[model samples]
Target chain A: MPEELPPLGDKVYLDSAAAVADIPDGAVILLGGFGGVGVPENLLAAMADHPARELTIVTNHAGFGERGLAVLFRQGKVRKLICTYAFHKSAFVFREIYMAGKIELEQIPQGTMAERIRAAGAGIPAFYTPTGVGTQAAEGKESRGFGGREALLEHALPGDIAIIKAHKADRLGNLVYRGTAANFNPVMAAAAPLTIAEVEAVVEPGEIAPEAVHTPSIYVNRVVLGENLELRSEA
Target chain B: MNSDPKLEAAALTPGDIARRIAREIPPGAAVNLGIGVPTRVANHVEPGRGVMFMAENGILGAGPRPAPGEEDWDLINASREPVTAVPGASLFGHADSFAMIRGGHVDIAVLGALQVSARGDLANWTVPGAGKGGIGGAMDLATGARQVFATMTHLMKDGGLKLLEECSYPLTASGVVGKLFTDIAFIEFTEEGPLLREVAAGLTAEDIQRVSEPRLLVAGTIGTLTREPEAAEPGA
Candidate 1:
C-alpha cells in the first residue's frame, strides 16, 4: 500500500529561528502587538540574533520596556519606525534612539495606521478617511469632500514580512487568539508576503474548529511554538 | 488666579470631573474613553445604563480592571492596563476596531486636553516644545466621534489658562470638542461659542471667567456643580 500523507500539508516549524531565517536586511516588518500583549517574543529574540539590519518596523507602539521589539531597537537593527504611538513611559529604548535622531519616525493617527495596513492586505491602493481632517495629520495628504465632510487620503502600508503571536494554531496554520491579544495579528497576517506565527500551541489539523479560526491558513506561511508570557495579577 | 490655596482646594478633583462627564453620557451610547482621566469616566457610569465601552486595542463592551486573580494580560485597554470584558463583549482585530471608531459608530469620545479654544478647537497630544509626543488615537477620536467631550484641569500646572480664546499648542483637531468638563466648571461649545453651563459648588461665574482667556457666555440658569459620594470600589 502507498504511504498515507499528512492532512493539509503541515506548516508548523519546530524552531522559531529557522522559520524567520530568510528575512532580508532592510525588510519592512509588520510586527503584531498592542503594548505588551500579542507580541511574538520568541520570534523577536530570534531576529535579535539574526543578521538582519536597517529593518523598518511598523506597529501600534514602540516596544514596552526591554523585551520584544526593544531587543531589536537596542541592537540598532531598525532604520525607521512607522507607528501611531512611539513614546511611552516604558519605551526607553525607542525614545533614546528617536531623541538621538538615529532612527526615523513617521507618526499617524492610530485608526489611519490600522486602516492603511488593512488596505494593504485587502489590495486597496488607498482610501479617504475623516479621522485627521483639518489637523496636522492631514497636512500634505490629498483631501476631498465626502458627504459634506472633508477627508484625507491615506495610502496602503504593506510589509515584506510579518511576525505575529497567537494563542493557538492548527498544523495547517489556522490561528485563534485570546481576548484583546488579537489586535493586529489577523490584519498583518494578510498584509505581508511572508508571514510567521509564534503560537502557544500547535494542534492537529482538525483540532481547531473552522468557525473558531481568527486567521485562516491561507494567510499564514509558518507556525512555531512560543512561550506564553501573560502576566498574572496578585490575587 | 495665581495658585491660591483656597481656590485650589475648592476646585473639583479629577474624580469629580469624571462623574460629571459620566452623568451626561446618554444610556445605550457606545463610548470610547481616552487614556488617563477619561478612563475614569467608565467607573462612574450608572449601572443599567447600557453604555458600551470601546477600547482602541480591540474590544467592545470593555469592563473594569479585572479582579486580582482574574486579570488577563491579553485583555488590556488603550492604556495597556489589564481589563475585563462585559458579558456581551465582542473582540476584533485592529483594522475592524478602528473602522468602528473612524466610521462614526462611537457615540462619544471622552478625552484629556492640554488646551481648548472657545471655538471647540482641541490641543492635546503634544506640547509646543516637547519633542514629538505620541499621537495615539487622539486625532481619530477627536474627529470621528459624534460628540467629543474633553476633561482637563482649568489651569495649566504653571497657572496658565487652559480655557483659551485660541489654543497656542498644536491642535489635535479643529473645532471638534462639543463639551468641556474641567476642575471648576462644565462648559459647552455652541454655535455662539463657549457657554458656561455650570460652576463648582464653591465658585461663581466671575471666578471661572477670571481664569478663562475666552469670554464665557453665562447660561441663563447656571447650575452648581456637585460631587456625589464615591461608589463602592470595584472588585472589592
Candidate 2:
C-alpha cells in the first residue's frame, strides 16, 4: 500500500545550493549555531543566493564576526527572526534593519530557545519553566504554580528545515562536531522536518565510529559536503 | 558613556569591582557570569579556589581566555570570546545548559545592571530609548540562580544613581537581586530595603548617601573595602 522509500546509501549533495534547492518561500528554518561556531557556512551561502523570500529564521544570534547570516539578512530574505540574541557586537547590519522595522524579532531566553528546539526533536509538545515568571516574557504565556514557584508554559518549536554543520558525516548521515561548535547542532538536526547538514568531510559508513556519532543518521535527510569553507565573503 | 561628569572620577575600576565580586564567590559554588564586566570576574578569581564557571553557551567550568596563539575558535564563552575549559569542564548541548539554569542547578549568577530598584528589581537588558537589546540568558539566570549578584557602577554617565527607589528602565526580573556591588559600595538587599555593607576607600557614609537614590542604611558592622595588596594606592 505504501510507496517504497528512496535508497538510503550515499546521501551526499553535489553542492550546498543543490542541497537546499527545494526550500520554498515562507518556510520556517532553524539555523544551528551559537555566535559563529558550528554554523553551516556553505548552506548559508546557498540560502543567500537562493530566490526564497519572506522566510522566518530561528537562530541563536545573528551570525557573529563572519558575514554568514548577516549576508542573508542584508539581502532582505528574512521576514521574521525568532532568536535569543539578535544583537551581537558586530551586528551593525542586523541592528540597522531591526531599528528601521524592516524585519521582525521575537526575542527569547537563550536557554528556553534551546529547550524548545530540543523538545520538538524529542516529540514533546510543551514544557513548563520558571525562567520567565513575572517577567515580560510571561505576559501572553499560560502559567501555573509548580511546587512553590510559578512556571510559564512554553510550546515546542519545530522548523521546516534545519541547516546545521558538523566536522564529519558518514554516508549514513551520522555526524560529529568539534568542541564548542557542538552547542546547538545535534539537537537541531533532529527537530526539523527536513534536516540538512553541511559537513567538512563525508566518510564511508564504517569510518565514523558509532560511539562518536553525535547525530545518528535516522534524523538526517540531506548532507552537503563543504569544501574550503569560508564563513566570510571574499569581496 | 556616562551622562553625568560629576561622579566619573569617583568610580572604581572594572578590575577592582571584579575582585570585590570574586571575594563573595564561595568555594564549590557553580556560578554563571553574565556578559560584559561580569565576564571579567573570571580573570580576578583566585587560582585553585575551585569556583566553577558556567556559560549559557553550554560550557561548564570555563577558564580564562586561551593563551596567545593557543586559541581554539570552537571553545568560546557566551560572549563568543575564546576560553579554555577548566580541569572538570564538561561540554553539553544548549538544552542541558539551560536546564542547569532554569532548573536551579546553578548556585550564583553575577550580572551587569543598568538599574536596580530598592525593592530588588532589575533592569539591565535594554536602554530606554535604545531599541530592544537581546535578553539572552539574563531572565533565566535572574530567576533560576540561588543567589543573584549585580555588579555595576553606582551612577550612570549622566550622574543618575543606578541604585534607585524604583527603576525607570524596563525590568529584567523582580526581587531577584540579593546583593549589589558598585564602584562606591556593597549593598545587600533585605526585606526592609538596601543595607550598605562596605564602602570603598576614603568614601564616607555621607558621600555614598549623596549619590544613592534609595535610602541607604549604614549596617551596624560596616567594613571598608581595601584595594588589592599588590596594587598601587589610589592616585599613586
User: Highest DockQ, which number?
Assistant: 1
Measured against the true structure, the TM-scores of the candidates, in listed sequence, are 0.95, 0.92
Which runs in model 2 stand beyond 4 Å of their true positions? A1-7, A232-235, B1-10, B130-132, B228-236
* lDDT, candidate 1, A70-103, per-residue tens: 8898889999999898777777889988888889
Model 1: which residue pairs collide?
none
Quote the TM-score that chain A achieves in each candidate. Answer: 0.94, 0.93
Question: DockQ for model 2?
Answer: 0.53
Task: For all candidates, state DockQ relative to the true structure.
Answer: 0.63, 0.53
Q: Candidate 1 lDDT, tens digit per residue, B10-107?
A: 78777778878989999999999998788888878876999999998899999888667777778888888888899899999888888888889999
For each candidate in turn, give its C-alpha RMSD to the true structure in angstroms: 2.6, 4.2
Q: Which lDDT tens digits does candidate 2 get at residues B1-236?
A: 44433445445777778878888999888999987668877777766788899998878888887677888877888777788998989887788888898778999999999999998999988776655577888998898898999988887766777888888887888899999999888999999889999988777777788888888888998878666643632211
Best candidate (score: TM-score): 1
